[model samples]
Target: MENEKHHIVPYRVYAIVLLVLVVLTFLSIAITDIELGSYTVVGALLLASIKSSLVLTYFMHLKFDQPYIRIMVGFVLAVFIAVVIVTFFDYSFR
Candidate 1:
């Protein structure tokens, strides 16, 4: 197998990502306090999704990885989303 060159991300970028993740965590916590009724769950889910994407992109080095890796990640994410949707649909009906 051929060795692939990896991109070295700067410490500053990780620091920024950490800061953003902290802020998003706080935002998710604060979101629970708001009186959005049924939308509160949706709001929290949105924030969580953003946080997950940030972790996946930066912390997982997906942002700097090869295109093939990104394609595989996309496929996996699509399957995950589909499963989540089906689970939620089943829950909503019951």
Candidate 2:
């Protein structure tokens, strides 16, 4: 642990990410006004996923973590997505 390197992220990057998050939030809210029916939940969920990823990568400092940590996060996310898809399909077919 003595040789561990520390990373200093610029405030500008955080600001940019925050701005993007806010914009996406508003976009999601605006999307509810449209009557897309079946696709509406999908759109909201897609935006939510993007926002969560940004929060994880930047806010949680996952981007600067070791490769193994990032890979683990990716694996977990993949499993979560698979479960969601399977559940969606199960309900959809019925």
Candidate 3:
């Protein structure tokens, strides 16, 4: 059997991602008092998604990965989103 090699993550990229995460955290907190109406939540969610993507792609090493892994991750995200939507509908009806 042949051995496969996995790509190693560089320290610089990790440091950059960490810095971005920190900045995002600060932005999320600072923006909470701005009163931007619906845009506030949307901005927070967008930032959170970015942060999650960074963590998933780098820390989880999904960036240098196979299609099957991406498919699985997409399916999981779909299920989670569906559940959130259903829950929101249920709550809204009440």
Candidate 4:
């Protein structure tokens, strides 16, 4: 078997990512105070997506992993978003 190349990410990058996630979390909470109606939920979901992306890329090592793995992850996320859209559409129509 061929040896796979390993990409070692720096600790500082992880630290920054963590900091960003924490800030996003706080922002998500803070946004709940204002009444944006439907946009509020959309904002929260957007923040959640950002947090998930950070976790997947840094914590899950997807950022340094192989291209195939990244591609698969992207595909899964796309499917998830599509499902969410369909569910929301169905509910809105009712």
lDDT of each: 0.91, 0.96, 0.87, 0.93
**Model 1, stretches more than 4 Å misplaced?**
none
Residue 65 in candidate 1, Cα distance off native in Å: 1.1
True-structure Cα RMSD, model 3: 2.1
Tens digit per residue, CA lDDT, model 2, 1-94: 7788988999999999999999999999999999999899999999999999999999999988889999999999999999999999999999
lDDT (0-100) at residue 60 of candidate 4? Answer: 95
lDDT of 3: 0.87
The list of candidate 4 runs beyond 4 A from truth reads none
Rank the candidate models, highest lDDT first.
2, 4, 1, 3
Error of 4 at 76 (Å): 0.9
lDDT of 3 by residue, 1-94 (tens): 1565678778999999999999999998988989998579768877887899999999998887888999999999889878877886797699
Query: Please, what is the TM-score per model?
Result: 0.87, 0.93, 0.82, 0.90
Candidate 1 lDDT tens digits, 1-94? 2697867889999999999999999999999899999789888988999999999999998887889999999999899889988988998899
lDDT of 4 by residue, 1-94 (tens): 2697777888999899999999999999999998999999999999999999999989998877889999898899999999999999998999
Candidate 3's C-alpha runs over 4 A off are: 89-94
TM-score for predicted model 1 compared with the true structure: 0.87
lDDT of 4 at 47: 97
Better of 2 and 4 by lDDT: 2
Clashes of 3: 0
